[model samples]
Target: MQPPLIERNVADVCRTVLDDATEDVLAVGPSPTVVDGLVAMLADRENGPSVRLLATESVLKASVSEFTDASVIADLVADESLSLRTSAERLDGPLLVTDERVVSLVTTDERTAGLATDDAAFVDAAREEYTDRWADAESFRLRTPPLSRVQESLEREFDEELAADFERMRIALAEADGHLDEVDISLLAAARNEALLYDISTWGEGVGIASRATFSRKKTRLEEGGLIETEKVPIDVGRPRLRLLLGDDHLRGIDADEVVSVAAELLAAARQ
Candidate 1:
């Protein structure tokens, strides 16, 4: 069955507000679309507005690509600064991120991003409540990306076959520490059948781990799923040497429920 049509009028409002605001505009929220739209809106010199944004650290980091030179608006007490705010109840839709006074509000709704709201009649009243808290709020600077760095990060790493596995590994282990760089998991998979212990030095010597033919074949298998990617890191002398992750057949012995339980435990701990 098809779901009911829910109109997203907030996007239009956001577009209108960005299109109209002349001076500095403040906004806050976790919506990437809002950041993207606002950044694009402000990037224009002729028709664009001056947009300032506030958001949670996670959202800010994830949407780093969308911002211009954003500084942390620490003066939450000041009417002109932007800061993050969340609602008591976790609502289904996006909330308004801006007030007429000075700061912006960030909410869960995707549509309400850069838009002005009819609900902002008490902007002054809300500012009073915010001042009490902003004085105690700690500030951190927003990270800006260099254009050169952005372009460098977008290039492909390994060939298609191994690329997909590396990409999936990165996604699955995104929160895992020490997993930042791209890896060719197929190389590890190739080492799986061999008894040869390949060290980083040996790998540098051009004789280590999986045979080139074997690794190449494994890459082919991974490519069948889809092209995956990760940043390639040269495994220099490491605590643990690189090897291809053993494929699905190795996981056949474990019950699926065990995996689910382990994942649930990790998630629960993460929330805490």
Candidate 2:
């Protein structure tokens, strides 16, 4: 074992370790900057050293913004050179292990401090510890469209569909003349956002319809008119909760944006 070499700048140590690495590179941290540096190193090689990245969910999300060239990351993954994963638990500090010999510990406090060494015992212990953590981590891969892009696409699609449904609801409300109120609209809007069913009391409170009796009466009317439906959701103890959901017909025919917008307005008013 050798004495660890201290460096004032973590970035310099990282660059040196990565530059000298030949066989493998293992990085664990929540630092977007470090991740970007690794990504750049990988991109520069046609066949870089096999790399494994372990990060927390927050770090991965931050990396999405930091590394705008998502396609490059995807390319590295596709070539089987880079493997990325995320841990639910937060890591203590940043570490970079290269070629089973060199190790770099990156620090962000006071200054960008780092320690590098080729100590066999220290490197082995760090590798073993990281291996265990890696086993429990969830794998992440940067796809062509990427997960964030897919989420944005889904949101846009939902918004467009909801807008169309709101137009229909507007006409229906005008004809009914206060028969269906803001509560009904709020419930419908809530249904559009991926929650198909909700407990009456909880959902009511969440949507700003506080009065139980009023909410119940409105719920009955909506159910009678085929706007929403209810079912019993089984619980481990006590009576089953009454779960409210959009009626099948309403879900199929209505656009969701208008209902959501109206619901938001009603909720805002309630708060004020």
Candidate 3:
């Protein structure tokens, strides 16, 4: 007999399987929505099943492309709320197998659904196959560092005043930042104090946020957009370090929390 197929909105497809699960959950090659969905679900509930998510590089890339969401993933992993891994091998799935049942996903433009079954043979086979695959997978790491780590680094390495400024921007930008990334925000924060690009970029790299090249490229882009200004600072080293500053009269001397909003506004106006 054919297993019952329950259709749902794409976001809800994973919830059904996750909610009904009594023990561990294993997912292989999940979709971006599924990955985000599981992450989001874990955010609201105190706890759910112990989830083991294994993804392909392509899907994992798509999932953590958003920095905010990726930050949460990092926190979840750090706390052991979610066990995430990725495989280099060819495994295509949005397949989910739980202690009580097995679920196979069906995705479409409008909705995603799951065909769930409790059959012993099907569930056991899926569980075994995916368990083996999970064993073969490696821990998935994202470029976005956990929020806690960022805070700790800022507070410990820099003074409280600077760290507070950074936290203010982070909180302000959490909801929306005109599409600015962590690099953009960090550069802006650094420019607020006319801090050196070398210092800021080095800090970012040490924090697992990004690389020096990435910061340099973003600084160039921001400079070209007239969002920030840089002046060469004399250093007793290989090259003169560049100091970051806000280029716009409107952005200069504004509150730390307001920088992202002003920058975003500037970007939107320029787009017009």
Query: Which structure among the candidates has the greatest TM-score?
Result: 3
Residue lDDT tens for model 2, 1-272 = 33454555554556557667786778888477777666766676655477788998777766653222454566677677778899888785578877556454655553454456677787788888888898888988553433233234433534644434433453454344343444465456544443333343344454333456666776666566555667787889997766666665425443553443343344344446
lDDT of 1 at 68: 21
Which rank order by TM-score, best down to worst?
A: 3, 2, 1
What is the lDDT, from 0 to 100, of the residue 81 in candidate 1? 28
Per-residue lDDT tens digits for candidate 3, residues 181-272, read 78888888888867899988998999998999999999998888889998999978688889998899999778888888888888777667
| TM-score to true structure, per model | 0.33, 0.46, 0.73
Better of 1 and 3 by TM-score: 3
Per-residue CA lDDT of model 1 for 1-272, tens digit only, reads 11222224334445555444445444544366655444444343344433444355555565542222221122221223233433332222233323453323233453232222334556555444444333444443444323222222222322333333333433443334331112233233122322122331233123222345544453444433222211233455654533433343433243322322233333344346
All predictions: root-mean-square deviation over Cα? 13.5, 14.2, 4.4
- The list of candidate 1 runs beyond 4 A from truth reads 1-12, 44-49, 65-121, 127-144, 148-272
User: Which one wins on lDDT?
Assistant: 3
* Ranking according to lDDT, highest score first: 3, 2, 1
lDDT for model 3 comes to: 0.81
Instruction: Tell me the deviation in Å of residue 3 in model 3.
Output: 9.4
